[model samples]
Target: MKRLKTLASAVVAGTLALALAACGGNGATTETTDEGSSTAEAATGSTYKIGVLQLTEHAALDASNEGFVAALDDAGIDYEIDQQNAQNDQSACQTIASKLVNDGDDLILTIGTPAAQAVASATSDIPIIGTAITDFAESGLVADNEAPGGNVTGSSDLTPVADQIDLLQQLVPDAKTVGLLYCTAESNSEVQIAMAEEALDEAGIAHERYTVSSSNEIQQVVESMVGKVDAVYAPTDNTIAAGMATVSMVANENDLPVIVGCDTMVEDGGLASYSINYYDLGYKAGEMAVEILTEGADPAEMPIEYLAAEDCQLIANQATADEVGIDISGLEDAEIV
Candidate 1:
């Protein structure tokens, strides 16, 4: 980890130097404004410089960012932000994480499992608050969720797997087999899968697991599962969330109902989900950051937090249900997206 951090620092330093050099000559000059102030006045007198590294572009991840920023604003916390999206590239995430560490931000906010992992690898001293991540221990982000013995602690978006499995069963009572789709590279996904498998086993439901290494293979792999399973179960898998349109296209063509891990996934054409509101989850993480930044709370001793069961929402796509010939009328309590 130390060697990797050293390499990341070198890469980011070179990249930042080239970036600065490219913008060196812009023919700009500073001048006094009508208010007797320099033209170089900042937008705000922010005392804090917060660095945000988002793993990829997707609805749930985007909501997490929105909520985090909104929370800071609501708290009247003055901050300068340097936010960057990795576009689902691990190397890009590493570069951004290293750059943030080198820039010496007051605190770092990482979205998604990979981004958190990248930031955790970059610095051990800088405080990190991660959102939209599941199973921090499984991802090796900390020694344990309770009493995380390191400079990391944040809210988890771990949907109750057994409850989600029960929802899957309720949605498709006749399903003899379910397809579990996720990214094989994500430890977060693996953690959820293990829990789901246990639930399926106890319920006597047969399931076939499928893995994808990247978004490029999602459509092909999903197409391959066409005739094999009655329905699909996708945990808050980032790769699948980024490629929901493709998954929807294939599943809809075959009239398969897909139960996902979050409300955004349902909005993106998934059949239904019993999951947490990612925006709320992110808000909680932002509050945690405030505690660390303002109250001088030690992240090394802060136990990881989670949303209550009542906080987990039931969201369903009514149009997808109609297209897939599933009866969601029984789920009247669920929020129709």
Candidate 2:
């Protein structure tokens, strides 16, 4: 474990923060009437000190942060945001979460489950809007999905695991056994894995788990399942998503069909998937933050938001298809990546 940063050194740590300021410039406007006194126009809106805690640097997580910022800007909320990335380090997440809480930010937006959990543990008084988290209840971030009894509530990137697995089966019909790949440390991935196990059981398909604790083990774990499982089903997991190049290289070399959970992963070199628009999910979370900051809405009463089935799209990678010898022509409405 890495050493954690103390709050006494917050300024030094703040300097280490990305310090991304997302707001319009020059809100000050001067207006003069018939009198000699000149009055300045009111500022566009309330300026807020916002803190963003992202788990890691990946396409999905990056999109979520961008979408959240876009929503805040569209709502006319002037905000100075401190962006901190854990870089998949647990100690870094804790250290940054503590600094953000100590910074006296008006609101905190966490992009991934680990980041949300760390910030939620740091302070409950500061309203937290989390995006890219799968199950709030399972993660202990909220009491219920409909009525979050606590301050933590936001959007859930809970992709349809069953439907995604079904896509894998459709792409590889003769595959007898499938391997579920993910990081065991992520609670969100655990929830999806359980659902996937149920889906596989219902379909009477044999399935096995290929779990890894960190990105360092992704290559070895994926390589272990080469011949044992005919197909691989990986969720929108952070660790696995970040190391997709390794996973694809190993799986593709063995002529294994790897089905991913998000469209961004397909672009990263997976076979096919039911894509979740993480940007829209983060935008939804940002709208919730707007309500809390400007509209005075309570996250405790806000229900967790999700993308409907109609919102999810089917996607496949033509390059991976040629490499793994799979046919995506049978999949309807699947956008080629």
Candidate 3:
């Protein structure tokens, strides 16, 4: 009877152990299923959201956004674009960036320096790409120009300032003193100014720096430099670019030749400009974004790139040139639009 009781007790213990083992196995299987389900949800092919924070409404920046969207569409990436224009307001830009981060955007595209800086401060995980920025280093995006060892990488719209100075020399050979006019707050303007100053030093040309902090002060500063310098050089500064009409009027009235950092300024009545096509730079940025999205590439690993454009065109406005009493007949290949 005692032996029977012992056997029964052994059987009961063995059954309970089996039951516990079964429960453990079931729990493991369920946990694995839940994890798999979570992963599946994470990998689900859903629409990606991209936030574009543009500083202002300008032709170049607008074109950049257009190019970026076109490239994403070409890649068949279903994405929703949320565009916000800061209108050159830094605080507004910060708000827009914060909202985009809080809203969980997969990527962020910044058009200008302030916008880029705002986005960088807002999030570290979301990939940020910038276009139309002159110098990434000057803009505080990276430590140096060679490698942007961070979460930001994009194209720079840096016009070759040395070549531009050489072009100016070709256009006005007798020009001894050149006036450099730009906005002090714009880092892009500073980058161009630094390059121009160095090139002028190399060329043995004397230059006067006239910087204005806003568009309202442009006309006065430029007017002051009119007769003091033989020629003027204006960079791709948003403030000055927006107020080109005033600069052109003053320059034409004083019969002073003006060389600009961008072809768009040339179109706006400046004498000549040599710079990369803004649209091409935008397209390159778009390409970089695609690489990051598709190839699992990190923005930090991508090197900052500059668009290569050859042959600076001598764009002479006939009316402006005639007004300035400057005549050049040697070059038929020059664009006189």
Candidate 4:
């Protein structure tokens, strides 16, 4: 009878061991999907595969990517990171997203709205974190902002749009018609454009909209409207940001001051911008990622993050101001770049 009891105890211990192995020893569970893809919960203390997809190669986006990686490094998490840039091409972003998903990344970080949307569409099983997106709902990435209610959540680069419009008015107070330049393809840009329109209309400022389909058309579009409007207002549009050289060239030639949405564009030649720090936004996103991956927090319940009001800065480019013959000296409290 004693021998029989010992055998039964051994059998029970073996079953318990199997159950623990199935749980991955860290409350993680794995299963194979119908598509033959393996999906598993993140297990702490194990090396994780992280994939980063950036929409373009602009300074703001680059700073965002840098901050994300820096935060990850600071967290001391063991992760294999694969970073890729789409060069402002949507198709390239799609391909990169698929490759990253197929690579079986534990998590994916997207820099812009396009990249985020691509990755979100590629795989619903993988967690996605996006930064530099203005409105997740407007971008169709999330159904609600307070609670993501889906597998997507991240930081927003939603600078104070109305305040930016007000700053543009302050810079060019005598301006009657402010030319609104942006790309129609980006929904993020569209959200900003609508806000700018409402703000401009509220100020009784007449505005003209100039649309660009791609980077190649920016110069011609800006040239056509340079002399027609008193000043140009560009929201945080990635296509226009990438082609700021041409936009600034046309604006400078016509002595038309340009008010942009971010400091990076100001540095690229726009006269001024009231914006949030993209790097800070990215760093915040990274911290959220660590919580989700290491702490096993669900991203679906994570609230969308934003840069604090204190972190927003006013950036003015002295060279651009001087070239455009705008006197920014009277502007008090602005950070001269």
Candidate 5:
């Protein structure tokens, strides 16, 4: 009986030793599999998310947004876009900025100055790209116009103020005084106003400023400037652009002609406008954003670029010009859309 028990114990020990050796070999194989899985994951890069914040819904702003998206599509990158419209509300703009920051976006594209300011205030880490902004210096996004030394770099939609003044003079040769209409709250409008004032001085033309805080004040402002100035110049102010119809109605009724900073304004019934295409500016901004994402370019390093095209179209409302008894002779050479 002792000899049979000894043989069974020997067999059990051998089986235990073989099982331990098998587990040791499997453990090494498992570690190698894990390392291979990690390598594969590192090779397949993760997708990125982009947030776009626009101040208001207007033709020009909408076109900018469209151009931005189109550029992104042209670059075949895996990206998601979260778009928010502030509806011309500053407070809403702040809220949208906060929400986008919290949502973990890789980059944020702000359409207008107000939206850019809100996004810049919201996050310092996330890259901020601005478009359709007139003056980065005036918007407080940068220290100077030439070098925007910060995390924010973008495209400027600034119309040449001196050229605009000259265009107005060409259209209205006999005009002695011009009235500048804009929004006081907007830094962009303020910048344009300053430039316009300087240009008017250089042209030897007398000019006055008519500033409004909101759309509600436009009628009163226009009425006040009617008999005071010969012609009115409206910059690309958001408030004025949104309430252009009212300004046009009041100006047309008062037999006044208005020269605007954008072509869309002319389409909305203004007498004429000379400005860059907003969509092209936005598309350029999108190209910059992609560079920041894929090429690993620093936003600060990318200087704020202006649209290359200085081409401005002279869109005239023939009916309105005729009604006001204003003669536009060289309009045939101008690109009338």
Candidate 6:
């Protein structure tokens, strides 16, 4: 078995206690839930339950959640979506994941790596669909990306980190040193950060690392990077994205252009981004989930999908460009948002 995440495994035992308590209060079991789903399929088809455990609230993640629901709606898949947000807390993901499992959801859609890990540890029998995750294999949510070989599978939101860094250089030509701001608690952030560093180093640019363990320290941590770096590069991180307003305020006020990994961050007040569409990413995941439910598709054979490179848009915050004194008029290819 793959090693469960430290925080997620720490709460797995407690999840069991809740699991036991749930059985005494209800007449349902996992087997019965499946039988009921079959019976519902023969009748009104409204008994299907889907658990949505989101890591946090951010425009990108929210768009993904919306896209997921939209897909189910368009497909006429009537399901009782139990939406749950962990509020960027790993422990909370563990608890919610356990509850979803104990509640015997037909499937679980985890919006981030932490939520995915928590649910993956909670139950291997229930199909888990993950989105907004950088790497399923790297995060240990699956045995392989191309072939999941297990119950977990979904689209990977591995943004073009290297290309984003290159665009950062083009956007901030005078930027000699860049500050990499991210949350250490987010594994996906670390992956993007490392890729960003490598891309920056290849271009012979100096960079610094600025990490915050939680959202409470975001403003302070971002504030500390003012004079130290010429620009800030924040990856598609849940904690940092949730606190983007503070980040933009600190960096934009200082005339430090922030190049982010998600387009939603640019809309949230960053300078620019070359990122994938989270809505499309989640919609694809929803289709995969639909195939699993309707066609009896096996998650094990499903390869992780991703948006095409052409789908990544070059987005710039026009208001931020005006504030940062960078004339983006020359970059006509970028869509000014």
lDDT of 2: 0.79
Tens digits of per-residue lDDT for model 4 on 12-50? 222111100000001111222111111232232377788
What lDDT does model 3 reach? 0.72
User: Model 5, stretches more than 4 Å misplaced?
Assistant: 1-45
TM-score of 3: 0.83
lDDT tens digits, residues 122-150, model 5? 98889999998876765678665456677
User: Cα deviation in Å at residue 309, candidate 2?
Assistant: 1.0
Write out the backbone clash pairs for model 1: none
Tens-place lDDT digits, model 1, residues 1-337: 0001111221122211110000000111111111111112234433677888888888999888888877776666666778788878777777788889999988999888778888998999999998887766666787867778998888888776677778888889998998999888777777677777777888899999998888888999999999999999998888889899899989988998898988888999999888788888888888888778766899988877777776777788989999999989888578987
Query: How much does each candidate deviate from the true structure in C-alpha RMSD?
Result: 11.1, 11.9, 23.4, 17.2, 25.5, 9.4
Model 5 lDDT, residue 332, Cα: 55
Candidate 4, residue 181: how far the Cα is off, in Å: 0.4
Question: Model 2 RMSD to the real structure?
Answer: 11.9
Q: At residue 139, what lDDT does model 2 achieve? A: 75
Ranking by lDDT: 2, 6, 4, 1, 5, 3
Residue pairs with colliding backbones in model 3 are none
lDDT of 3 by residue, 1-337 (tens): 0001111221122211110000000000000000112222246655667788877765667777777766765666556678787777667777788988998988888888778888999998899999988767656787655678888988877666766777778778899999999877776776677777877998999998998876778889988997799999997777777678889999989999898877667777788766556777778888888777765788877877776545334455667777887774544556776
Question: Each model's C-alpha lDDT?
Answer: 0.77, 0.79, 0.72, 0.78, 0.74, 0.79
Better of 1 and 3 by lDDT: 1
Q: Model 6 over residues 257-300: C-alpha lDDT tens digits?
A: 99998898999899998878999999999999988887789999
User: What TM-score should be assigned to candidate 5?
Assistant: 0.84
* Predicted structure 4, TM vs. truth: 0.86
